[model samples]
Target chain A: MASAREMRLRIKSVKNISQVTRALETVSASKVRKAINAVTATRAYATKAWQVLRHVAEQPGRDSLHPLLAQRKSVNNTLVVVITGDRGLAGAYNSNVIRFVSQRFDSNAVPVKYIAVGRKGRDLMLRRGKKVIAEFSNLPAAPTFGDVSTIGRLAVDEFSKGAADEVYLVYTDFVNMGRQITTVKKLLPLELEGEGLVEDFGNKSTGPTAAYEYEPDMRVILDEIIPRFTALQVYQAILESQASEHAARMIAMRNATDNAKELVGALQLAYNKVRQQGITNDILDIVGGAEALSAK
Target chain B: MTIRCEIISQDRTVFTGDVDIVVLPGAAGEMGILPKHAPVLTTLKYGVVKIRKGGKEEIFAVAGGVAEVQPDIVTILADRGSENIQDIDLERAEAAKKRAEEYLAKSAPADTDHYLIMEAALRRANLRLDVVRRYRKSGMRIPPSDN
Candidate 1:
């Protein structure tokens, strides 16, 4: 049973907490909208890019030219590029992805290297004594394709030079504001839809009647396009992870705000009860004193 | 017969409508397409895309990408482009061109990747500046370049 003064002080502190959480909730809500917009915009480009690559991959003998399309016979080294937010207040967003990745890696198997795009993922991997080849942190709120190109280039260079046998991207897929699923997708050994690499993009295939003519040749165009394709894939993943991060943060902040509101309500009720008890005690004391005086 | 011409970029759809004629900058040279054209797929260059429909013409500044033409549809998947002439920022384009040119001038020929990137950037900037300048000279609401 707290005194009136103690209850009043507790209520004031709870009110402050609620105010901060409410402000954070509003901020995250706006950020989520911006992140979603970025995802949709990138989706348009990614779809078209995938479609073009699929068409080229369907060509006969064209897939043999680019090294990115080749798969190694034995898995020796693997590079996992983990993307997470720099800040943590998001509920289970960063942890879910990191856990999904760590569970997949076994120390007895092929050696795994990590390339972290955010601070949270980087710190987690370092603390666990994992091999972190490169660390990129403090990315802008809305990152451009150029911003993530370094990661793409590093992955490509490693795989192409036989430094890494496999490359995988671990990220969170943004379904909507309420739902985000952690996913691990392969980034190397370029696989088209027909080869079981990319899922169907719902585009109708060009029939045999419409024989396509390439400007220079199939090989030259593919030589130029494959690198862009790899870069675009990485960029799209970054954008998706960003959107998911914002959505998770928004939901987490909203929950915090709601919980705080409930606490404030309970505290106010407790404070009122204690105040009433104090007033009643004071009245009883005064009334008893007067009765004694009258008797005298 | 009119064909649907859709110019799509990474960010947004630059232009999409039924047009009588479409002239795009092909890798070889300027190529024009009409209805019932052959099924051809080719890469695009950094230049303007002139779309004419019902005696009205629209121009778009396009960067590198691919173009696909069928009997009834012409789809352009550009890396980046703009359909609205008014949206072209001449000063920014000029600055980009200058920076790319300086980089190219200072870079060694052995650096193939940097050379290729700078070259592409310069070409894109040139095309944007060219389109915007043409619009201003044609007395469209744009003001002429100060330089």
Candidate 2:
């Protein structure tokens, strides 16, 4: 049992910790709201872009249309772009993504490289002795499309140059405030039609397909749209990851604050018990002296 | 008949409404789409998108992007653009242009990505400034160029 003075000091320290966590919770709550808004706001555009890409890919002989759409015969080299939060204290927000990626590429079947988008991921990759071709860190909280386009371009260039056979993007998808799922998506060779496409684009494919005419021809339009669409996908993933990071941080801080409160409550109870015992002992001593004087 | 026009940037949808006609700065040239027009998919250039509805006209300065024109709907996906002319800040555009120009002038062409990015930045800035200067209300005075 800690002394009364030690218990008092412990309670004070717990209260101070709760204050810091409470402040952090408030800040993260506000940031999560903004980040979530950013995520939802661009969802419409992402759906539309995906639809267009699907439509274009559905056309015959689409495989030869663009290098992005063309799949390699065999994937010799693989690049993984892992997006994580710059700072920690977001529960398992950063570690979850890092672990998912490490587990995913644990097998040395194919030669793999990494493109780290955040500080945590970069550090983890370096510590693990992974081949990190490029590292981008310290991205703005609410990054703009321009801020992330460079990563997309690097991936695109790597794919086009035959340096990387396939590119995968690992990110935490923001489902709701309380739910975030780690998602692995194919970034290169553009998964136009497959199992995941329907899930992502929804049941909007039931509508009739329109016969589209391409101005300045399809090749030229695809040349411009493919790169932009790829960049948009990367941008959207970053937005989702940022939202998830904030939400995770908000929840973690709230839990910390609650735990601190619980600790303080338990310590306060013990401190009170010790204090009462001291008072009772003092009273006992005083009463013994009184009884001795009365008997004398 | 009016055509539904939606201009979407990477961040958000800028405009979505019915318009009489929409003119896009196509990669080939300027092309206008009316209601019940043939489906057309074209690459956009760094210029203004003119949307006419009734007697009023709304203009948007779009950087390079793509325009998809269906029979009833026309979707303009701009790389970067403003919904309204008033959103374009002249000083900011000028400053961006100056910065891009300075970087382009100083840096060597070894790095293709940076060079292309700066070039696009300059073009977008130029397009914004041009759109504001040309399409602004007659009463609004043009700011003097620092050059």
Q: After superposing candidate 1 on the true structure, give the runs of residues whose Cα lies further than 4 Å from its correct spot.
A: A103-109, A194-213, A289-296, B1-5, B17-23, B31-41, B50-58, B68-74, B84-147
Against the unseen true structure, what C-alpha lDDT does each candidate score?
Answer: 0.78, 0.82
Off by over 4 Å in 2: A33-47, A102-111, A124-131, A197-212, A293-296, B1-3, B35-39, B52-58, B85-147
Tell the DockQ for candidate 2.
0.49
Q: What is the C-alpha RMSD of each candidate to the true structure, in Å?
A: 5.9, 6.1
Lowest summed lDDT across 10 adjacent residues in model 1 chain A is found at A200-209
lDDT of 1 by residue, A1-296 (tens): 97788888888898898788778878888988998888887776676676666555555554364567766789899998899989898888888888888887745388899899899999888888889999888998778888888888898889889999888888787788898878776778756545554432222444332556777675666667777777787788888889999889889888888888898899899888888888999999999999999999
lDDT of 2 by residue, A1-296 (tens): 88999998899999999999899999999999999888887876876776677666665666777778887889999988889989888999998998899888879579999999999889987998999999999999788777889998898899889999988888888988899988887877767555353324222532234667787887777887888787777888898999999999999999999999999998999999999999999999999999999999
Best by lDDT: 2
TM-score of each: 0.79, 0.80
lDDT of 1 at B9: 90
Docking class of 1: acceptable
Lowest summed lDDT window (length 10), candidate 1 chain B: B138-147
